[model samples]
Target: MNRLLLYVHFNKEDSLSTHVIFQLQALRTIYSKIILISNSHLDRVSLDKLPYDIFLQRNNKGFDFAAWADGMRMVGFDELKEFDSVTIMNDTTFGPIFDFASVVDRMDSSESDFWGITNNRAHSADIGGQLRPLKEHIQSYFITFQQRVVAHLSFQYFWENVQSYDDVNQVILNYETAVTNYFIQEGFKYGVQFDTVSEDISNMQNSDFSIFGVKKLLEYRIPFVKIKAFIHNAEKPEINTIFDEIVSSSDYPSHLIVDHMTFADYPDRDYLLSQKTLDFSSLKGSRTRVGIHLHISCEDEIESFLSSFDQYLDNYDLYLTTSLEEVVASFDKKVKEVILVDRGINAILAWQKIQDRLVGYQIAGHFEESSFSDAIDSLLKPAKKIVAYATINEKIGLVVSDLTVSTRTEPIDEDSMWPYMAQLWNMIYPHNEKNLKKQDIYVRSATASFWYRPKALEKILSIDLNALVIQDLSAMATITHSFSNLLTYVAWANGFDFRFSQPHLLTGFEVRRRFESRPFLMVEEPAILQLKSSKAKRIIGYTIKRLKTIVKKLKY
Candidate 1:
């Protein structure tokens, strides 16, 4: 009589229950006796559904490796001596009807050949060649599904020789690999039914039903089988639609109805706004203050502002008013203030109210007349006293210039190429006393070239200057002045003087020679040259002497 034993190992609950059920139902007609080998902790509901004849075990062994090998040994070829062959499987596998019969025939005909099966073609080469089947092998066992009698003898043979319980289990992988190699080395005939249709029970939705009837047979070696199965499926339309709606609603707050903005719907906004208020409370009475007002229309610009601001954490008392929560979250803990308003009417209305209270005039919708004059007047009263400006327009120059001129006792020497050092001084000290009869005391300097600002910095900051010059200049002026105040405060706290002074534009050679004591002949040589017909050398020599005399007077 011919009989068969099917073996399976299952790990997770979902696959253990639903997936394994489908495979068991499919295999019930072919194999004589079905055996399930698994861990004890499986869900009871899933376990109770199996047929009465199914063999079950609670593998309580300390090492899973040892238990698996012991489980194979317990299959007992002696009890099933009446059977002609047997089959082995894993929880993740499901085979076509012919798989069992074909594998058993191959083993019977080959006479003592070991057999293995796989659904992946890639694994065939791996098992045969580089895997050196005897060396590197996989322990996730799936082998013959065939006549019970011969299969029982092979399983019995494997069990008796099992050495160290752990090593025995581990050796299963090597055994499969070794058996594959043995076939090639000894010229033993091996057969693979690449056409066998088997679905990986692990993959449910896209089960491979094509090779459901063919079985791969190897005489002494394990045959590999390949099949395509679906592990993951694309999102269904309902879920995708809901996801898109949520994203759109969250991004366009102004378009959302007020009722839709409830805490349940917009949890992230609620959390961020609460955090902003808490942060604002921490800075109620700070001595010096810093604030960022981002009015950019694009998300990238807002992010860039926040990123650039983060680098100056130690230098500012930072505040932010923007729609970009991601950018704000990146700021340091000391940046303890922010105001949240929507990008539409709420932002404009809030600003209008602020302007009215501080500047004394309302911004009428009309652009024609000075309906907003009172607002500007009110703003000037408070703003003039406190606000300073800084700009990212030519940030490197501005930073380098600030570092240089703001140092009182130790002036930056001329060799430094801090960006816009010259321009920054011109802005900070608009009235150059040397050139001015009286200080002009301008509030802001005229806009100048930032051509030398690093392209890398500019890209990182995302500063766009393509708008009208006047508007761009005003915005940059506001930013630069605000930044300067922060810089001055930081500098002053560090024991460095923060007052601006005019930069020395003198060349290195001229600076060194300015105070050198020239011989009387050296001074007179230029005079003698002036008397001669040579104009160029005379001009240079005379200018050098005059500069030296000026230096001497300044020292005195």
Candidate 2:
């Protein structure tokens, strides 16, 4: 069967992503010809490397629908009409999870003039500048048209009249949803491979299936899943499980998903935070190459601060930075190195002076004067947890402490600092500033204390600290505030996972119990003993669950 595939792609980075490359490779098996249309800032060098028979590069004025129209126009109506089928798809989805050959083969046998993997059920929506009810239509993300539909003048007419719209809803309602309605009205039959109406309908919308019913879609062997599944609806526990489900069910490389999520904008920053956090409370001790870089400006708090971390000091080398001669004179024990910087140099500048020490260590921590004194006890568990996590998961490179771990009583007013941070971020990552803002990815350790891997500081270390602070103390403070929040973006931009450290959230007994339970399950023991332990755990869990239910009932 002769088939043509028009794939639209857009990336802020001006380069193709691993998943898109994988998708093109997969689609090559089923499509006779593939055209890659990009609405990104791809240069000729990047465009020349695209794995497609043809390429279309244009300004990103109108989103996917406009890209599709341009692709159709480039192909010309006469050439497009000759193909047995034409499939228009976009980079907004993750896969061809199941083989594209199988999907195409199944759809080939269908007699409908048009088909899609799924459909948006008839619903009310804003269209052409007003709210109105609309008929069901095939989603534009992936739709296949029979040769007859393409040859029809109506199809040509549709493309000829396509206009660029600034708003995406205008593109969706007027083009994506409207196209299907237009074709059906022209007497063409349409079919959907996975019909939402055939499934459970109570409180379920077909439009939400790509997100909420992704597991079910994979179960049914659908070829693609929306990327939005991972980007939005993060409040749902089901969203967190999508990654696991995809890995467990398909042969697709899981790293593609991980790499994308690291940079992709997730609206719910907390959800993304929860996704990447490492909690290795089960580990016995810190073994990974670890170092703590402490900057002491307050002479009075020096002894107390060191005393707070005394228990964990022996496990790792300690590096200190200070301008106070008294601090250098009085500090001793576990001191691997000490560097003197300008008296008023910010912690960031102090960190920069010792950037040469970042190598060889798998984990590095930063702390400024009095940053952890108020919450030292709360900081201990996370310090150990970060070490354990770094030892196991190399992907996680940065972990900032949660607000509860600091003396600050309110959320960081990031909006006030955004302008300053934006300037700093632009200086470091010029190409990514737009996306950084669009993703709303601001996160910071209010006290400027956090744990990070050495590699995550690669871009940050390149920053010109002297230039940043040459103006005045106000410039110094602005840069300091900006740098704290920008660290999260810096980690992510460098393909490292960023997480939050939740200190003091669990009691000592609870932490110990949680950690103990895992090893207890793993212990090599008699079959009877293991079974009894498992049973006891189940009974304990059930009893706790039931007591909570009873409490709720009594309160109600």
Candidate 3:
């Protein structure tokens, strides 16, 4: 078949990723002609590497639909009719996990006017704070149009009228969802490569098949896997199973997925840790050298902290930083060295003092004395597992205490620190404007305690302390909260994954289970989520409000 492929792509970095390159290389086998339309800047070097017949680099105003429209126009309506098939796709997925040629050959025999890889069921969308009903449509990520459909006047009219929208929901409501239905309403038959109706209905209704049934799709030999399956459906433990299946079932490079996960803009900090969590019990007997930087701003928790370190000190080197002279004699293990600094300097600056010593270990951990107020023992609870995981995987640049995962309900006060952190981020990554959306993606532990590689800290450590500007914070705590967020950002930005570690016994799930098993667990839930999820509660709440109104009326 003479197939024309229109591939739309965009990224914050404005460069081609290895996975995208891999997809294009595979696609070249099935596509007779391929046009690469990018809504972002791509330098000559990047343009030269793509396996495309033509490349269109345009300003990133609209999303994928606008790019596809431009691509169709560039091909010209007359030229599109010549091809047996035309496929419109985007870079939001990682594949061909299955053979593309087989998929194309199978779909070629079908008599449908147009088809897509998957069908999105009817669902409600919140557009401008108003819930709007969206009709079921063929997913926009991968849709192939037969020549008959492409030659239709309605198809040409649809492409010609396609334009940019200020809101993506507007684009989806008008274009992505409308395109499939538009063709069907014009008396053109449409089909999907994998029909969900014949298979499980539960996975299809009110949920995305690309996300919820991705593993099943791959098992059914669907060519591509959506990236959102890993990020969005992280609560499901089966995501890891999908990753393992991809490695065992296909010749696709697994490292490319890992690379994307490490560097991509994650949905939030919770997904980051959940997707990249390492099994603590499985990793044992690691020979990697580990160093601990214990910064003691206060001596109150010194005894408890050192007591917990007794088991770990035999295998790890321990360095102490404190202002008090008497606190030096409190360790059971031989202290490698002691550095004396003023009490209020904090972990950020104190680590700056020990940069020379940082290079000696494969795994370096930073623990603040102030961070461990009464919970000092819990700080080092997962130290061994953390070091073991870091040793086994070179990609892990940082592993922080799992406090962020546990206390996620309580938000960080980034408002006060925003002015300083924003300036710091811009200074570090001036070219990447996505850095300005700091609070949205900020993932940091309240306690600045984390295990990291020496190289991950190089970017932040390179900047002098005098460069940061802050207001209304103690002279000592100026960089504490902001620097915590920046620390994780720099780690992931430099092609290193950050993980969260908690004691095996005290997992977030276990803690939640302990609370939930109690009678009063509903009190812990947010009122809005509680009322929405429970019909009985909503009725009871209504009854109470009605009774209160009656009582007030009677009293009057």
For TM-score, the strongest prediction is 2
Taking all chains together, the TM-score of candidate 1 against the true structure is 0.30
TM-score of each: 0.30, 0.63, 0.60
Compared with the true structure, all predictions reach lDDT values of: 0.32, 0.71, 0.71
**What are the per-residue Cα lDDT tens digits for candidate 1 across 1-556?**
2545455454532324333554565556655666666655556676776642555565444233334455545665555554554555555332331245465555456544334443222133332234422332222345442333234444455445544434433444444344344333544333333322243434322222222211112221222211211111111222222222332333322112211221112211211111111111112221223332223233454444444444422223333444556545654253444444454322222222222222211111100011122222212122211122112111111111111111122111121222233343344335642121111111111111011112212221222121212354544433333322223222222222111111233344555564353432333444444443433443334334334433433553
Better of 2 and 3 by TM-score: 2
Judge candidate 1 at residue 428 and give its lDDT: 36
lDDT of 2 by residue, 1-556 (tens): 9999999999987766778878888888888999889899777776665678888888898888888889998989899988999999999888877676876777778888989988767777655678877778887788899999999989899888899999887787788878898998899998888887456656544355776677678888787888787766544545545665676578987667666766676322332333343444554556555778888777776666667666654467778898877666677443777677788787788887887786668888887765675335434555675677666777677777654311343323345677777777788878764356522225566456878888987787778866767865666766676777677767777767766565544444553565465532233345325344534443344334323323333443
For model 1, the run of ten residues with the poorest summed lDDT: 361-370
lDDT of 2 at 249: 73
Cα shift from native, residue 96, model 2 (Å) = 1.7
Q: Scored by Cα lDDT, where does model 3 land? A: 0.71
Instruction: Candidate 2: list runs displaced more than 4 Å.
Output: 127-129, 205-208, 267-320, 323-338, 341-486, 493-556
lDDT of 2: 0.71
Give the winner by lDDT: 1 or 3.
Answer: 3
Q: Name the regions of candidate 1 deviating beyond 4 angstroms.
A: 13-15, 60-75, 94-141, 145-155, 163-173, 179-190, 195-556
